[model samples]
Target: MLFCDPSMLPCYRSVQCIGYLSVKIHRFMLYTFTFIYSLGV
Candidate 1:
């Protein structure tokens, strides 16, 4: 809906995908760090 124009749809979708992947990667990194710290402790 925000990108109603056809020309903008691809750009909007790509941005959305990138945002989602970044969030997932960030969470994964956080969890990995926490797990490693716990093991070290």
Candidate 2:
């Protein structure tokens, strides 16, 4: 079994948040690009 140190919880949470935010940003950029492409601009 693997053990997680209590002191590392914050670091883990921050990493999770960064991952989530990056995914959201990527999705937003993809949507915007598609919209602009559809406009032929």
Candidate 3:
């Protein structure tokens, strides 16, 4: 789901900037959502 989920655009972009590097797609998405949720954003 690399940048495919519109609702996750901001989170995805933020994660990208943080540098996922060569991480797996599912792992990246999971990390992004967890990070966002933790921020209560």
Candidate 4:
């Protein structure tokens, strides 16, 4: 069971968080991942 179903774009829209909020959040996650990767290397 998934507690947070972030796979659906409409999820954020349903909450009135705007259309691109998911994309922005995805970008932030990628950036943070890269930062942590570089720090570990």
Residue 32, candidate 2: Cα error in Å is: 0.3
Per TM-score, what order, best first?
Answer: 1, 2, 4, 3
Q: Model 3 — which ten-residue stretch has the worst lDDT?
A: 1-10
Highest TM-score: which candidate? Answer: 1
Each prediction's number of clashing residue pairs: 0, 0, 0, 0
Q: How would you encode candidate 1's per-residue C-alpha lDDT over 1-41 as one tens digit per residue? A: 33334555688877876777788899999999999999999
Residue 12 lDDT, candidate 2, scale 0-100: 86
Q: Candidates ranked by lDDT, best first?
A: 1, 2, 3, 4
**C-alpha lDDT of all candidate models, in order:** 0.77, 0.74, 0.68, 0.66
Give a tens-digit lDDT track for model 3, residues 1-41.
44434466687767764554446666888999999999996
- Residue 38 of candidate 2: its Cα lDDT? 94
Model 1: colliding residue pairs: none
Task: Write the residue-wise lDDT of candidate 2 on 1-41 in tens digits.
Answer: 02334456778867766777788899999999999999996
Clashes, model 3: 0
Local error of candidate 3 at 39, Å?
A: 0.2
lDDT of candidate model 1 versus the reference: 0.77
**Least accurate stretch of 10 residues (summed lDDT) in model 2?**
1-10
The segments of candidate 3 whose C-alpha lies over 4 angstroms from its true place after superposition are 1-23
**Where is model 4 more than 4 Å wrong at Cα?**
1-18
For residues 1-41, what per-residue lDDT tens digits would candidate 4 score against the true structure? Answer: 12234665666545545435676789899999999999999
